[model samples]
Target: MKKLLYAIAVSATIITGCGKDDEPTPTKVPVEGEITGDITANRTLAFGNYTLKGMVKIQSGVTLTIEAGSTITADKSNGEDGLVVLNGGKLIANGTSDNPIVLTEKSKVAGSWAGIIMYGDAPIVNSATAPAPQVATSEDGLSLTYGGSNAAHNGGSLKFVRIEYAGQVITTNNKEHNGFSFYSVGSGTVLENLVSYKGNDDGFEFYGGTVSGKNLISYGNSDDSFDWQDGWRGQENTNWFAYQTGIGNYGVEVETKGVNNAFWPKVTNITLKRAAGTVTEAQSEIQLDAFQFKANGNGEFSNVVIDGYINQTTPTAFTGGAVQIRDLVTYDNQVLTGKIKITNVKLNNTPTVFIT
Candidate 1:
């Protein structure tokens, strides 16, 4: 009987040891460090805190996947800091509403760092009658050219990503970067639920891209809240909201690099609001309009809501309007020709419809 009891006790001890061995290991926390250099292979950044030290480029044929709840602080004090997804590369940053991916600067001030820039091989129209699609050089000081014939090109996916205090000046001639600059990104790319907050320049600028943006928010940007150039023709853009504060120029500044094309961008369900004390970039009477169309910029915009775009100039030097045509050439060619279609616009606290 004693021998039998000893065998049973040993078996029970062995069973307990096996159970302990089956337990899962705890996930390790990542140490904080600066992220730089060109990513040549597939890499995944798990949930952690990181700093962007310099020009971090996700090179071609590589995929950089960032997990949700990651916080990347831009170390602007070090040097020119920015993230660039080159053409043929991918940046999959998919975050949830509960825990969004945040890229911000430590200074918490505008123009603190260069912002996120992505390049894709998307079709763009630069000449009025070019037989082939034309590409343009990037003005973000990256010294790169972008544009191609891949209308379905896919740069990557971005959701619930917030960029703060970006739009740093990168050129020696005083050209600043936007908060989110899309350079010829194609239709297969996914951009949604993104926020550009308190940038020194435009909140979101598309440079000849076919990728559409959905549920985008631009708040407190100094320049235009939404700006596009180089014949951007995104057809599925919707639900864009902009709130200009402190200093601002226009709610929407549209341009096509002085080219009037048959095809233009289409956007719906937009909201632009300005605080009462908002001032223009010039601090003068030149750029206080809600919507300014120039350089043959034409689009199909509908269901827009404009509010609080009051002219804050001293003694009210000029009359502000909900729509300001910068040149008579754009008015004659685009607006009169029905290329610039703006319908179902609702105004609240707006001074005029067209600035005379």
Candidate 2:
């Protein structure tokens, strides 16, 4: 009787095990549609279309992975659409040259929306002596604090990305956004082959960071092409090209918030060009210089090519030059100390090489 009961139990176990194998596998659905609000957990965006609504923030301790060939369109109807990666957050957006990641607006107008803003815990010198690890509130009206002692902080990687028709004004105080804003990002972050096209404000602006960019293109921006402040020390930057059209200011604007420090950024293989019919911000303003160094700004630039800084409709007073040392203090301190250096310059159809 005991042996018969054991054989019956074995047969029942085999039947139950075979029933479990008949269940179907579950499938993963792709994420699509509008994206907004805060992201607190790790998320991956597949190669598809997405619309940005309001302000989308990637909070700390979270990683947002975007696959290649993804298109994120900004809905400027709200006028607050942008992507902000807070400190300690990571965004891995790596796209190939053939299939680049695109962030654009549907209206296709400049200043249509805010651009990509990232904050990292990198070293920065806002003042000569503020603190050991300098910190300051964001100027984009978010009022968030940033800056730290980590020089090798990794905010994540961005390659072969294109940002178009961004640079929205966030506050009534005239705090405008740039196409790409790196706030105190570190050297471990990767930025390469990025393009900022037809933005209203600056194409690329670094507010005190050690992150270097290579193969950067700023095309047809109304404001300055490349601008940096607060003692940025990107040591390995190369192949930067800027083509200004419509109305613009400087091709490259450098400043250090009046701090005369030993740190200086370095760049190589630069090209700055202004179209023939291009004008300045205002009819009376002659702010079309190719390179403007002010407020103790210092950098080492090599193999530069500047061309067509002349105005066609305006008189000689409105014409611009290749380089301008805006302040006497910067010229005396930074330039005289060999902190500001430019080598192997080639000028093509340039009215003046230096603005006095």
Candidate 2 — worst ten consecutive residues by lDDT sum?
1-10
Q: TM-scores, in order shown?
A: 0.90, 0.89
lDDT of 2 by residue, 126-206 (tens): 888787699888888788887888888888999878899998987755867899999999999999888888998999999
- Relative to the unseen true structure, what is the C-alpha lDDT of residue 345 in candidate 2, on a scale of 0 to 100? 97
Worst 10 residues of 1 by lDDT: 1-10
lDDT of 1 by residue, 96-156 (tens): 7656788999988899898899999898877776676688888888879998899999999
Local accuracy by lDDT, each model = 0.86, 0.86
Residue 328 of model 1 has an lDDT of 85
Superposition error at 352 for model 1 (Å): 0.7
Which stretches of model 2 miss by more than 4 angstroms? 1-31
